[model samples]
Target: MTDAPWSHDLPWPDDLPPFDPFDPAIQADPYRHYAWLRAHAPVVRAGRADARLYLVSRYDDVLAGLKDATAFVSTPPGGAIIPGLLLMLDPPLHGPMRQTISRAFSPRAVNAIEDAVRTLVATHWDRFLASGGGDAAAGFATPLTMGVIATVLGITIDDAARMRDWTNSAVDFIATRIRGVVNPDASVDSYAAMRAFMADAMDRAAADRAAGRGRDTVIDALAALRDEDALTADEADGFACLLFMAGHETTTLLSVNCLDQLARDPAALWWLRAGGSPAAFVDEMLRHRPSVHRVTRYAARATTIAGCAVPAGAPVRFLIASANRDAARFPDPDRFDPDRRGAPHAGFGFGMHICMGSWLARLELRLMLAHIAATTATIAANGRRVPVEGGAFATSGLTRLDLSVTRRSA
Candidate 1:
């Protein structure tokens, strides 16, 4: 047992386990830990490693709490592992910000991009095929999705590297809180750097709006918000900073997850070739390998969830990964069934903080998957497992996905 990866980091109790997230024991296999929580402390009152707060790991309980906005506030400056990001904002404010920017993600706006997105997807896959195969996560996954986000924001892929750096550093700080450890993401320098960049962008967008230029850019639209007094200079910076956060990482993680699934099940290629909907495929991929393992909530007032008591101002993680895999809610919870038709998985999340970028995410994934399956004849493999990196608490995933490919006939 001592030799087993699971043997070490035996169990997390009143306090969080020591912050050795890179331990092969936990990463090589986390199912045991998940299973333990599922069976034992689904909604246990655990002490924070450095502070005290509640934790929720059960399916139904997590679902309920996520939707309960009155009892749980999202606006606390400290509740979030990451600060200044909109994910921490609760309603009446979080509500309107979502509604205002949601025009970008409206069903109509998403549908209008179908053709353009498809073209980008096909073009990227063609490039991938020419190379004979590469790390899809880097070469294909990131570019395909980030390109669209960049297009929407009126930025260039040449500039994406800088944004990725900022997003990673920001998320790193956020993860430290989830793991209850030193503040790795607490980079005052990053905050100043990010704030300066966004401030510049906002200023340019404002100038563009006054000139009637950059109409198609999100930056332009955001600048327009400033004119309407809908967003202040600081608020615009915060919002753009958050939008940049959403634009960079998640879709990249999701695209890799989708492609890797298709690669593992070679038959999926045929399924796609048969005109199967990429939308459905993306849904399944999210269920199987969600990017955000869990969403956190803090108690605004004392409340009980499924027999667990949480005090006022207590922080809790919704354990979204566990919720998605709950057998009671999902059929054959452990199995990855692309065709499963029933309840939706907790992939985008539920409740007040549901992901505002979800529709765009789905549209982007669908386009990319369709293009790859149709354009690439064969995807090559360098024979490496998908990389999953562990932070003190949060999981960093899909560092790279190595694959080779042959293009469809010109």
Candidate 2:
């Protein structure tokens, strides 16, 4: 494999395989390389010469690193590209930021949106069926996820689409820089646009609440926190951007991944149709074909992971994808068996930084899958499979998946 553009900045060990997840070939199928890493070097340093990126592959090691936030920090070496992003902050600081928006995701709030999510799924599925077949990623999955997130954040669907575009641009910008390439202007512009958009959204949400015509929304929650001095305006905007980036995008990927995996396994689909638990199906899918592949942390002090010594302030990467597929953790790890049961997977991450949106995502996937089983007799790939272009190390998902759908006989 070709070296990343930033290799000269911080040379990697020659022994390590030329493994760059963003490389299209590796992105297509990374399991072989992951197997190699797990077997040979569970912990190894890789990335730009200037940036110390240590990758942990084994399941238990990754889980340990994720849970040990004190040693393996969320803040990274320099700081978050976007300040006040909750997922990037370590504890003490992390708790307050998380609590600021936690209420919006409470059990009651999420349950209240169940009908809205189902209606969104059904509406999109109807449109897909009308066309006989369509790209499930864009035509169905993304819209459904974006709609749900938009509803929760009290933003228009159009606004959510715009915010999503900005989020993608910003994420791409940061990913490139992390790889040692420098394309700063566009990504900076994207973050600025998102901040401006979210600020205005908060204003509107606050006005609505004042007028006594308010609905439950993340924006209003953050606005309230800002009023209480629990969060600053910039922090609130950053969190709003996070909601768009993490909340909506990951769920969209999860939906696409579920469709892709189930389409490839007829027996699994049959199980789901024959009264298998949708929750279990989603859990297994998270392990077998997770949307997120890795999460980053910085060594707060000198520490060792998987037996390798890491210096203080070094950047570390936990390979959640590889961890989930670890043979020691899951028997016949590669097999996709919804009926399989045990400990939860690292797909949503581990410990404090574990995805708070996971419950909301699980609810969406469960409902979406159940609805598919009830309405469609079979779904098969009819065209191309376009993997998302970048964020290879971070998320694995499709940008387009054309599928043919057969509706259940009336």
Candidate 3:
């Protein structure tokens, strides 16, 4: 099979070390490449013909860029095919927009669902244990994430599964589209179907509210907010769509990543015990192997990253996973020390655009590790593992994690 053109499309200076973020090998293990970039060229120009991306690797530069959002905007330099999404908005617009949907994921709301989330996690773990060994990501993490997001969105678990399929199809389609290839999956149709699904759900929610039979879900809240003229219909739909995408995806990756780390360093399982701090371990895992590898920004105006002149509207890609492991910022950056202490890593992110669901994501991870510690004596690799393809530049996660485990006595 011929490799896709984008796979080797990076245009970098000859003086800099060769690095292809799209390469599968690099995706599987990118620390060496990151170290090279951080040392040789903190900010280097790369990407395809039409789109040029500047990679920022050093911890200082990445964090500074993220903190200075005015200079480095979240919206695409040339705008996106799909607009009005929260992450794709800037400044004044981004603030008001986030306010409208933030209530759904407020600390109060997320904490209230702790019991339900615990139940969901236990149920799936029980099934996985019964089967002896299986893909941890598929069997446990994915379903647990799906269930929590569905509950938050006020939808059935079955509907969450259906939504997840549509999400996968849409993501596949987008990947192929970016590569300028045709996909047979009809992902455009799936994208359209998802939009229509959200639209119809919003209408139903409005009608239910008018009749005083309102449902208390994120969808319902967003729709009501729209009715109050707090947001436009399009904004509400965009927020809901983002919730569907980011909500489950990041959490799934975190759970799988933590599990993978524990399996590799079985000794770390001690940290998950009550005597150890599970929350601290979760933070360290994020620093050691963050799910979000990179975050994109647009130079809203002519700016410089690490002294490199970046023209206005040019794309800037921050190698956040690299920043999390910057030796200058964190001592022994590569080591996975649960008790490692320093400044907080850019795992979730930093500044205005930091992950909105961070609280909930942490809650999920903390509970997951606690449960694993309580129920399992040991976890080890049982078979081959396959990492998720295509999205490694943006997200780090496994599509499959086969693990063997021993259950602790009740």
Query: Would you list the C-alpha lDDT of every candidate in the order shown?
Result: 0.68, 0.80, 0.78
Cα error, residue 260 of model 2, in Å, equals: 1.4
Name the candidate that leads on TM-score: 2
Q: How many backbone clashes does every candidate have?
A: 3, 5, 0
Q: Write the per-residue lDDT of candidate 1 for residues 170-249, one digit (tens) a residue.
A: 66654455445576447656656776787787688778767767555666666677668776766666677777787657
lDDT of 2: 0.80
| Winner on TM-score (1 vs 2) | 2
Quote each prediction's TM-score: 0.85, 0.91, 0.89
lDDT of 2 at 236: 86
lDDT of 3 by residue, 269-362 (tens): 8766646788898899889888889988778898776667888877788989999989998988889998888888999888888988787788
| Model 2 agreement with the true structure over 1-410: per-residue lDDT tens digits | 22212223333346544666557666666777788778867776666567557778899999999999899886656543455577777778888778766855656556668888889989998888778878998889988998999988878999988887787778776555443456655467887888899899888888888899766677887887777777888888888887778888788888988888767876767888899999999999899888888888878998887667888888788999999999997999999988897767998999999887788899899999998888887788888998866664687778899898888888
lDDT, model 1, position 271: 81
In model 2, which runs have C-alpha deviations exceeding 4 angstroms? Answer: 1-17, 80-83, 106-108, 172-183
Q: State the TM-score for model 3.
A: 0.89
Better of 1 and 3 by lDDT: 3
